[model samples]
Target: MKKLILVRHAKSSWEHQVTDHERPLNERGFQDANLVSNNLNLDGLKPDLILCSDSVRTITTASIFTSNLNIDESKVIFKPELYDFTGGNLVNAIKNCDDTVGSIMLFGHNHAITSFVNTYGHIYIDNVPTCGVVVIGFLINKWKDLNKGKTIKTVFPRDLRSSIHSR
Candidate 1:
């Protein structure tokens, strides 16, 4: 079985005048990233490989997962195509995954990410908010044979934040 996890980059800063690719993560982005990363770690779901967009926000978000999940730097791959706004490019990336890897994670943008999850995942999600995560599992042994799979899990920062009981 092959497992694929999709993560939408955390909220980015519009305060800067830089291009979209250079825009960095805002304070909320950092907190959200940390929250999601911690949640994934607590769930004990580790990725064999993580594919991330080279954009600043996405990279920063993926880095948080790397740190919190203890994923080695070598396992993280920065793909320029993931910067794409459509899911087709993202699907191509998944199709190219090495079969040796059992589980993979992708940190990217939407509506592509949202489309991919809803298009292929057995579940329909209205939206994948910033720093949201969706896990889909395919029964195939090879990445090339990837087809619509089961939506195993979904995690969102607001859900976690709301679940907290303050002192």
Candidate 2:
């Protein structure tokens, strides 16, 4: 079985005059990233590979999860192709992933992230909010044979934040 975990980048700052690719995460983004990552229960679903968009916001969000989850930094591969907003490039990237990898965690932008999850995962999430994580499990042995899979779990910042407030 192959497991695929999708993560959307945290809220980016619009205060900068830089291009979209260079925009960093804002204060709320940092908090949400840390909160969600720290609260995640991986349940032994350690990723063999981490595919991340090279954009600043995505990279920073990935960094927070890797650090919080204690995942090795070496496992992360920055892919400029993953910066794509459309799901096409994102689909190609996942399909092209090495078969040797049993599991993959991807960090990317919206539309692509949300679209992929909706198409591939069983759950119909209207939106995968910033710093949100959706874990899907595929029954196929090869990445190339990927098809509609079960949505194993989801860790959204809002869900975690709501629990915290209720406590």
Candidate 3:
């Protein structure tokens, strides 16, 4: 079984006049990233590889999850191609991954993330919000063989907020 975890980068700040690629995460982004990552139940499944977009917002979001999960920084690969919002490059990047990897965690932008999940996963999601996580499981062994798979779990900051605050 192969597991793929898709995480949308945290909410980005528009206050800066920097280019889109250089936009940093907003304050809410940091909080949401921490909340969602801390709430995930990995069930002993850890990512063998982490593919992250080279953009600043994506990197910051991925870094928070990595820190919370105790994932080694060495496992991460910042790919410029993953910055795509179209999902085409995202699909290609995933399909081209080494066959040796059983699980992969990808940090990217949407509608690519949302579109990919709805297309590949069994469940249909309206949107994958910032700092949202969707875990998908495929029956195939090789990355190239990835097909329609199960939507195992979804962790969104909005959902967590209510539950956390209630408790």
The global C-alpha lDDT for each of the candidates, from Candidate 1 onward, is: 0.92, 0.95, 0.96
**Candidate 1: which stretches are off by over 4 Å?**
41-43, 165-167
- Mark the regions of model 2 whose C-alpha exceeds 4 Å error after superposition: none
TM-score of each: 0.96, 0.99, 0.98
lDDT of 1 by residue, 6-70 (tens): 99999999999999999999999999999888877425657889999999999999999889888
Per residue, candidate 3 scores C-alpha lDDT tens digits across 1-167 of: 99999999999999999999999999999999999999888898999999999999999999999999999999999999999999999999999999999999999999999999999999999999999999999999899987999999999999999997899
lDDT of 1: 0.92
Q: State which candidate has the highest lDDT.
A: 3
Residue 140, model 1, lDDT = 95
lDDT of 2 by residue, 1-167 (tens): 99998999999999999999999999999999999899989897889999999999999999999999999999999999999998999999999999999999999999999999999999999999999999999999889898999999999999999999999
Residue 162 Cα positional deviation in candidate 1, in Å, after optimal superposition? 0.7
Angstrom error of the Cα, residue 145, model 1: value is: 1.0
